[model samples]
Target: MALLPAAVPALRAENLSKRFSTTLAVDDLSLTVPTGEVFGFLGPNGAGKSTTIRLLLGLLRPTHGAAWIFDDPVADVARAHRHLAYVPADVALWPAFTGQECLDLLAGVGPGTDLAYRDELVARFGLEPGRRARTYSTGNRQKVALVAAFATRAPLLVLDEPTSGLDPLMEREFRRCIAEAAERGQTVFLSSHKLVEVEAVCSRVGILRTGRLVEVAGLEELRRLRRTEVTVDLSRPAPRLRGLADLPGVTDLRWASGLQFTLSLVGPPGPVLRALGETDVARIDVREPSLEEIFLDYYGEVSA
Candidate 1:
């Protein structure tokens, strides 16, 4: 039997670092996204997410380490770029060109493009194709970039805060496009602070914090490792919750209106269950925290 060769990853970074003046913008970051996977790079603002993106795009050279778009090194800007399409956080278009013209130009420059799908995207995004770029609003400009990127035949799409000025309805449409891209076997590297958006599309996520890669895991695995929020309502007031206060893996304990107790729990619930038996509980609600809550655990009061 003959062995099959391994497929090249869509994106790869090893010990990637970037520094601006005295500030270390991106610090020793490493990550990989397999071909055709929708991967999310999650972080708060100024967590060096954009810096990392720039480095990957070869717009900024890393102070150390390297990155690749498939087998092409990012240092070879033109070669690496041929393998991916990029939509930045902020988009700037040729003011004199109409929206349709802009889309045409983008399609022409890319490795290839699905022109029929591009037309459909223009309609789906509600872009006024005849309008000059200068007349387009911020959201419209973003739409132009999105339509171009999504319509391109490039294997990988690098999106940085891709939904900047989009309204909720358009945001939903953008997510739909992402699903279509994945269905077509396109790899997407999505960088954003929006937990809900990432949770909706990304199969795997890497959390960046202060220029460093802090965690990378599947959503389910991340949830399992984090604390769950639990609320308990008692039939009547208990004299004390002495055991719960000192209970292992219990934190943020508080008493609410009408004998309600709320707290976060981690690890085994056996201890928590045993303690609750001491009180006359009316109702109990336990839920896995939202992705945003999990994000907050990693960045508390850090302006996420």
Candidate 2:
């Protein structure tokens, strides 16, 4: 495929920073999102993720540096935004209007006359098109907003905690929509405090703290920090197990709920697993840390 006329990032924040009074909302944050991949903007509460998104959308100006969407400045977002769509965390459609009417109104916002799959989207979201937006539940409103956003076939989708109010069934449907969008070459920038959702859908994640980007890598790479749980289920008492935790790349070593003990180890598992091989092994399950577990360590360090 030929290169695009401009080699700009699908989305970018170059040393972007923002300040509100004494608070530094975003501090020297930088990230480059390539085309055709889902990049999850991850952080705990008050990590400046939303503030950065607002800057990217030209809803708010950065105190320093610049915001770019498809090589164009934030000031030029309108000109370049025909290809962009945003589903804010709060879905605030007009209360008096129906779901179909909201879609109609958004259709006027862009070139979406030929929404061939609009009906399909309504069915998939299980939304009643005739129902008033205000009467809908939170999850229903999210679906209504999502159907409107995805139906546009925009080249870029900026979803801020898109699944926040969604039920499990709706979340499953939402994931499918995002997956299909990526398969069709749409770039997705998902901002969320929910790490589990990010771990499930994002190809890569960028973690922010105190308004600065602290880490950016594939979810698997982040999980690599606490990989290889070397557990030893002893038939008899082995008093030395707890003492060996600091041997090398070991952390969170403890006896779990029942018969199994868990230890997350780094490096070639040969040494650790080999050492465990000598013990009477009941079972061993080595895997990556959960997103919650990873964030606990990650945020603890940054916040400290």
**TM-scores across all candidates?**
0.80, 0.80
Candidate 2: where are CA atoms >4 Å away? 1-6, 111-114, 225-250, 254-293, 299-304
lDDT of model 1 at residue 294? 70
Error of 2 at 76 (Å): 3.0
Clashing pairs in 1: none
Error in Å for residue 102 of model 2: 0.6
Query: In model 2, what is the error at residue 107, expressed in angstroms?
Result: 1.6
TM-score of 2: 0.80
lDDT of all predictions: 0.87, 0.77
Please name the candidate that would achieve the greatest TM-score relative to the true structure: 1
For model 2, what is the C-alpha lDDT against the true structure?
Answer: 0.77
